[model samples]
Target: MNLEARKIEFVQEFLKLQSEEAISRLEKILRNEKKMSENRLVEPMTQDELNNRIDQLESDFQNNRFKSSAELLAKYE
Candidate 1:
């Protein structure tokens, strides 16, 4: 069958699932699959885009928009 048909078939079969353990396992698998798909959808920036991002970060740093690593760690301790 085609993708949509298979998806509908999966939905029909999934609706027939009754065991709590089976459903919980399926839920975990679906969450991991979604995270993986989202990561795959992210496109890498070009060289000019990367340079602009670095320039913005440098400006933010110079304007005191960042914190030191030691200061950040001290808050948790």
Candidate 2:
């Protein structure tokens, strides 16, 4: 089966879980897997890369390329 189908099947089985221990174990596994996946995807930035990003941000701020906090809040609201 495809990923979506497998996920649906897993959810259906999960919904039928009657044991607290089983549910807790699944939750722990899910949390650990999520953390592992995130760790795998993220890497530490080099000092030069970090400095370049800071410089770019400063340039953007000086050029007024960003919105104010009030403007962002108003847009969401």
Candidate 3:
């Protein structure tokens, strides 16, 4: 069957579940699958985008618009 049909059938089967443990396991599986899909949705930066980012970083450095490593570490402590 197609994706929609398979999802509907899966939902029907899920609705008939009686075990709490099984439902919890299915919930966990759904959460993990959703997280994995979200992670995969990140697109890689193009060369032009990367170059722009590098230029911005250089500008920030030249203007002294950044913090030192010790300053950053001190914030957490």
lDDT of each: 0.97, 0.99, 0.99
Instruction: Write one digit per residue (lDDT tens) for candidate 2, span 1-74.
Output: 99999999999999999999999999999999999999999989999999999999999999999999999999
Best model number under lDDT: 3
- TM-score, per-candidate, Cα-based: 0.60, 0.58, 0.58
**Quick one: best TM-score, which candidate?**
1
Cα error of candidate 3 at position 35, Å: 0.5
Q: Which of the two, 1 or 2, has more TM-score?
A: 1
Q: What is the lDDT of residue 28 in candidate 3?
A: 100
Q: Which residue window of length 10 is worst by lDDT in model 2?
A: 35-44
Global fold similarity of model 3 (TM-score) = 0.58
lDDT tens digits, residue span 2-67, model 1:
999999999999999999999999999999999999999999999999999999999999999998
Sort the candidates on lDDT, descending order.
Answer: 3, 2, 1
Error of 3 at 8 (Å): 0.6
lDDT for each residue of candidate 3 in 1-77, tens digit (9 for 90 to 100): 99999999999999999999999999999999999999999999999999999999999999999999999999999
